[model samples]
Target: MRRPSALRRLSLHRVMTHADYVSTHVVGRSLLVSIAAIAVIHAFGIVTMGVSSTSALASMLLAAGMLYAILAGLAVASMGDDLGQGYASLYLAHPLSRAEYFAAWMTAGPLVVLVAYLLSVAAPLIALNPSSMLDASVYLPVLCIAGQISFHTSVAVFSSILFKDKSKAILALLTVIIIAPTLVVFVGGLLASAIHTVDIMSLVAKIVGVFHPAVFYMPFTPRGGSASLSLAYGFGASLILYYLGYRFFKYRTDI
Candidate 1:
């Protein structure tokens, strides 16, 4: 017999079923709510700040915080009700392969995050302060924020896949939330305290800040400043997480 075409192997029926399920699922609804929340929060910040020079900075930071919240919410929402287990089961039961299933999930999740971030942040910031648009500083923070979101989302997805239990996934997320800041502070604090100087803490703070989406969009640090370097570091960290996530998903069949 002639070899089945790629399309034939990935049956249209299976693809359609997956798409339908995703559309009807809470994931879609959660995405909508996240986007709306980001937009509303940023708009309020802009209005409250009164379109002043400082307001632009404040709005940018607010937008970044909203994006971080959305990303965290997405991870938590996916973990609730054993959604990841259900997704894995549905994909494995069908003609679809794990690779295809993962591809679809990764593609959809990041696109949602990116669109929501841009719509919530870039649109309003530019509208209120067009000059800020031309500043390299503005773009740098956005890049850092994007990197942070990607890295966190990847980690969350990997945790969901590996843990198999929704509660465990939630725990994983909470662990990250609780640990990251404290670790940063402790390390930075220790370095500064030991040296009897604030410079060491400032350096450590700048380094750790890159990994956080909320810190990236703050206007105090311009695009060409240390924040830019931190954003670059965030992108590099994100790549490593993506690779690890891919490896874990590729080899593990227990899901």
Candidate 2:
């Protein structure tokens, strides 16, 4: 029995190796450090440029989302290349199950990126010393940005494996990148519109606001409840995508 247990442990070791491959290859450690440097520069740019805080925050929000989405796309592209270029042949020849490999790959990308992003943001907050922007009300939804990134990353992983080509994988990622947010905003708007009868400007704000998360620590925004709903959708959708990815990977045949 102990001998069988030892064999099982040896077989399970591939999962960690798969995770290591993702951490080093999918998103390099140096790249994460460079992002931190960029964050520091962004803070300096904000201080010297006399940019309005609201506009600055909004720009950061959108930019972060776009940047993460692109990185996630690249990650999928890299993994798809691995599959397409026959790396998967050597990889799958081991005692490891495809499900184990997929689980490791799927989990590693989001976690490593999330850790990097958090480290990148921390330096900026410290160096900037802009106490004004620290208001929870203004930047509250920023907390959920990691979840949003993971959601995009999960979609990329699934689509990439299913398509089995880096180019097609990226295309699939882009399709979801465009369609998912639109759907989220539309659904959030429908919910928001049911509660408030507002004009074009207000309604438009409400619709856009649906993509932000609410801070339980602060008083409500004009559309705070919807913002909370948006946060839930963002995270909830990530969970769903991750499950779909895992299942697909478990059943997927090697290329």
Candidate 3:
């Protein structure tokens, strides 16, 4: 009986994992296109401008402006199948814990994002500029940019679990990335001016900055003065959000 039960548990894990992997097919194709596009950009730059068109600033801006939308979609695609498509009932009908299901989604979604960055972004950059791989000046910023993208991806995943709808999840992510911070700063500024306390706005801005973790590494050329602090905040916030999302998924009755 014990052996049979253990085997059943193992089988469920594989099933969940495979489902999550299959859901990433769209994201995988997008990443493949990105890789090809980046390579072409490099080739064009070499022929026309004497160097690769891609730079740390361009990469950071891309991550902040456009690439994040793709990554966020990837994040949502992994879990939306179960939550949005009513497959959660089928999966949960088994003796599987919700924790295991959540873990499988998290694992597969972010792994694809990381691999995408390596192949689509980093590899092409390095292919054209081999020496930069060894130069800390070059590689460190790239790694930091990747970190920023990963942080956003995690936030996107959290939003998907929170909203439980693919379209809303992506919308919420864009709001956090593009709108919330600006609004917070504006409101914070007004409150500070009214109270004659600049710290009020500063305090509010720092708190809101957690949602847009990529800002910490902006202007990736000079590098931020608070690189270590940015890493700490981004990593800490991601862990907190992940824990909250997992707990919500595990205990929520509606799902």
What local distance difference test score does each model get? 0.58, 0.58, 0.58
1 against 3, candidate with superior TM-score: 1
Tell me the lDDT of model 2 at 106. 57
> lDDT tens digits, residues 33-71, model 3?
554464445344433443343453345434433464455
User: Which regions in candidate 1 have their CA more than 4 angstroms from the true location?
Assistant: 1-20, 26-31, 47-51, 54-63, 66-73, 76-87, 129-131, 186-198, 213-224
Write the residue-wise lDDT of candidate 2 on 1-255 in tens digits. 345433254444677888777657654666545555554554554455413565455456546655655665566556677777888777778776776667566546655555655554544555565474476534444555655666677667777777777888777777666655477557666877676655443444444433332222112333344445556766777787777766666665556
Task: Give the Å error, residue 103, model 2.
Answer: 3.9
Clash count for candidate 2 is 0
Query: For model 1, how does the per-residue alpha-carbon lDDT over 138-160 read when each residue is reduced to its tens digit?
Result: 65556666666666665666676
TM per candidate comes to: 0.73, 0.66, 0.67
Q: Let me know the TM-score candidate 3 reaches against the reference structure.
A: 0.67
Show the lowest summed lDDT stretch of 10 residues, model 2: 211-220
